[model samples]
Target: MEAPVYTALAERWQDQAGLARLAERAERRLREHPHGDLTRWRDALSRLPPVEPSADLDRPDPRLGATAPDLQGLGETLMDLHPWRKGPLVLGGIRIDTEWRSDWKWERVTPYIDLGGARVLDIGCGNGYFGLRMLGAGAELVVGVDPTLLFVMQYLVCRHFGGDLPNYVLPLGIEDLPEGLGGWDAVFSMGVLYHRRNPMRHLRRLRRLLKTGGTLVLETLVLPISRPGDLLVPDGRYARMRNVWAIPGTDRLLGWVNEAGFENARLVDMRPTTTSEQRSTPWMTFESLEQALEPGDGSRTIEGLPAPVRAVIVATA
Candidate 1:
């Protein structure tokens, strides 16, 4: 896939010396990590017909332009990049019903955070779906970081149709970002905290990424507990996700946030994930929420862990 332009840094990050270095580091990482499927994804992106990019981002599906004349060919090319995880994007008259009805999650998050003219960092941002929504909600620039090459390629596809807006998905993980560059207006860590072995360190790093009084919007799997500091360290995989390390109670997470030096940490929204919100679709035919949970019992995973009940927490740095 072609490297996305990192010009968004020029707008606000020009004053931060490290952000220029960050742009260079991101470029180097993209150049060095030559994913084996890069050529295939590039070909898929190339197949899209050239058209003026037009988008309506303030919608559930985030419509992009109109139907291509060769709709079947357009759909086929998009299908070449499969396993779409984080969107229900509509582009070129094709509605990609992704594995996750991410719009539903966005709806829950939108009311809690204000992105107006803010620079944001979205960790584990899959396909830049939320980044697009952030821009639609008035964010000036959204610098998304995700290590998954497939997700990065998927973002390039979105950019192809959505035009080169301020939404950028860099093929770099949160750890790849340079230290001491803390001036983000808002930082988001969604569906990422549980995967970290050192949750406190993760929280601290998130704090460091934001400027003073910057907002941190965090969403992650949470379990209810009778007392603060209670945590669930799954002996093995929870809900078939191997990388999930810990699921904390909302109170425990808030405590961690406070200990990380964030102020006014509070839970904004909490809800159980349902099959309707995340399920197998034509665009992502692999097993999803349905297969991950125990048969007939929706409240628990097949492994008998509490089913994925996510919580959104907001705090100020």
Candidate 2:
């Protein structure tokens, strides 16, 4: 069956000429690249009983629930798609304890952006959790882009419960977006820059996607140095994450953002990740922050690299 989420998305963006091709391309991609467990996920999605879409974005638990009596069944269906990473969502009576305390990230970021009636994009958005929060914060539209099919499925499940809001997660990446597609009021690139082989190129792409004087909220893993040019290029992996390419210092990160033509680039928040913020839970039954760290020291990763410290920077494009 065709996903209802796409239908809602098409209707929402039908009036915007700039988004026509994007919407079409997204639809084609969704149709062409069905995940191996797409049918199973879809079936699981269908089993979820209808509920009112009421999101509490300010709370630690972003909830969508009703007084439904079949919450046990709903939880079971949600469990079918496991390894939930970016949420602590409360649906019905079930609280999905995810791997990452994404709410903490949200708390760090929400204060910096003026989301009221803004058009926003979240790069590497996992499961559209933050996208939903954007909508809850009064954003006119929130379009999240991620290449992972599993995350897309999880987003669709959230969309099903959220009742056709103006939020969509396209199964694409920053590279998949057309160049010079500028119009968004704010562009967010959280937990994405370090993974890119060329972080400057990623920043430039992000700048290209925003309008004149638009804001860019960038959050990424960084080295703990206080200098401007220092950077750590991991030998193989950082904290068991294989794709991590470069961990730049805050000053170096600001330099890259400024070089990318972003103005007023400044670091807003910087802090190391903690076990309380990211640990294995029942919903995500795999190695987590606790397991990824060194056995004797919490400050370093298992690979003996400097432990994960993330920084959030805001700039004008």
Q: Enumerate clash totals for all models, in the order shown.
A: 0, 0
Candidate 2, residues 227-274, lDDT tens digits: the string is 335799989988999999999888888999999999998899999899
Largest TM-score belongs to which candidate?
1
lDDT of 1 by residue, 25-72 (tens): 777776677788877887897899886687889888897766788989
TM-score of 1: 0.95
Q: List where candidate 2 sits over 4 angstroms from the true fold.
A: 8-16, 52-58, 226-229
Candidate 1, pairs of clashing residues: none
Assess each prediction's global lDDT (C-alpha) against the native. 0.87, 0.83
Q: Candidate 2: worst 10 consecutive residues by lDDT?
A: 4-13
What's the TM-score of each model vs. the native?
Answer: 0.95, 0.94
**Given candidate 1, what's the lDDT at residue 307?**
89
